[model samples]
Target chain A: MARSTYTLTIPSSTRFLEDARQFVETHAQEAEFADTAVEQFKIAVDEACTNIIEHAYKGNEDHHIDITIIIDTDRFTVRIRDEGESFDPTSYKEPNLMELAKKRRAGGFGVHIMRRLMDRVEYRTRGNVNEVRLTKFRNAEHRRNGDQA
Target chain B: MSNFSVGFRSSNSIKVLDLQGELDAHTASELEAAIQKCQDEQHYHIIVNGRNLQYISSAGLGVFMAYIEEVREQGGDIKIAALQPKVFNVFDLLGFPMLFDIVETEEEALSKFHDAHEEG
Candidate 1:
């Protein structure tokens, strides 16, 4: 159960990604999360939003990305909800770095970064909305291994 | 706010780009345009100085990936230098260190260009 939950909504545009990251940074810092965890959460949220703007909304910039920050006794989570296109998790493949560079591709790295930084990354379809939930836990094992990524 | 910009600094034949402010999806296009301009002007040996770069996302990294092959194929390289630890961590997270010439100082990046020139 969450002890506290905060929400932020931004226009579905890449220009607003920094605001989303700043919101995460302030709340995560106030929560006294470890520095590494705070950084991870920020990047994860940014990537999630970037994916939504580019892939989900397809750069339409007319939609909204609803962000909910859930802080519990044991975990900190960022749930990003968007009304854009639904993502197919099964289609996600870990990108080959060299292959992408060789092909002159500039994307296909955001989801991978989100999955590595957060302890859990979940996708859900509720009615017409699409949500990608990213969570990082407070634990000794996590603290020890989280930095490995 | 996005608030990102790139400034150009030239050292001999090398073009050094000073990157500042947040770098994400919208602002990444600015970086891409700067690089594109460099390519257009036939300046291929490039160094990105990120001392003032406050943040980055995968879209920002993607710009580098998109330009790297073309730059290298032209017998030039993109050397990244002086990134803030946090900014560099994003690059590291995506395994950029292996595919990029990342150095701790602008001098090192410049020296790399010098070394290549001397080798020629």
Candidate 2:
């Protein structure tokens, strides 16, 4: 599979989240993501980065978030790796959406939304380090030809 | 720590939060903390006045989603008012209107809250 990758290390802050999203969106723009997919991808990156800033760094804004963008003709894969601790996002149960809708809870829904938006989501932890990988595939071949699908 | 300002006030039994500037991943936490404070104080009839809010990313939505349960558990609700069309479109696309009672003005939200309180 032909792939290209770029990695960045930055403090676990929202600024980094913007940079990361911009990087992904800019690269993905070549494929022209559908408006909904663009929005979803932006949301997924924001949530993942927020998790790194909140849970991984534990409010310490000094640590770096190691982010990798893997691009291919068929899909874009974003991998977020942090050294803070071995935390598995997959272990976090999908909060009941029925209850979520009834109650309007805010925080726990990020991972759930990310899972919903991405084509593939995997989480693994090793040696006290956590990694979250999200994949989104390009389906609109018409858009690839610069035609809005 | 993202660039934004957040303030809260109470008017006619409605707690209003004024969020200005960008509400993205970076600045959503500040809003979250403020909302939590209101919830912690048992103030559930909340109104988010976003007239000056320029943008709201998914990260921002995550914060509100976090508090959905807290407000409802108290027999209260969170209402959004004066969302810019762009922001509203995002909310609409994400189906926030179904989850929240989004209104066009602070006065409207206040009236609704008053009506709900009276009816209950």
- What's model 2's lDDT at A129? 76
lDDT of 1 by residue, B3-120 (tens): 9999999998899999999888889899999999999999999999999998888888999999999999999999999999988988998899999999999999999899999998
Output the number of the TM-score-best candidate. 1
Give DockQ for candidates 1 onward, in order. Answer: 0.87, 0.40
Over 4 Å off, model 2 = A97-106, A125-129, A140-149, B7-16, B32-45, B51-76, B82-99, B104-111, B117-120
- Per-candidate TM-scores read 0.95, 0.70
When candidate 1 is compared with the true two-chain complex, its DockQ is 0.87
Tens digits of per-residue lDDT, candidate 1, A1-149, equal: 54999999999987788789889999999889988888889899999998888888998988999999999988888999998889998899999999999899888898899887888899999988999999887875663235554
Q: Which ten residues in a row have the lowest lDDT in candidate 1 chain B?
A: B1-10
Deviation in angstroms for A42 in model 1?
1.1
TM-scores of chain B alone in all candidate structures, in the order given: 0.98, 0.95
Best by lDDT: 1
RMSD in Å for all candidates: 2.3, 5.3
Native A-B interface contacts kept, per candidate: 0.90, 0.51
Question: TM-score (0 to 1) for chain A, all models?
Answer: 0.92, 0.79
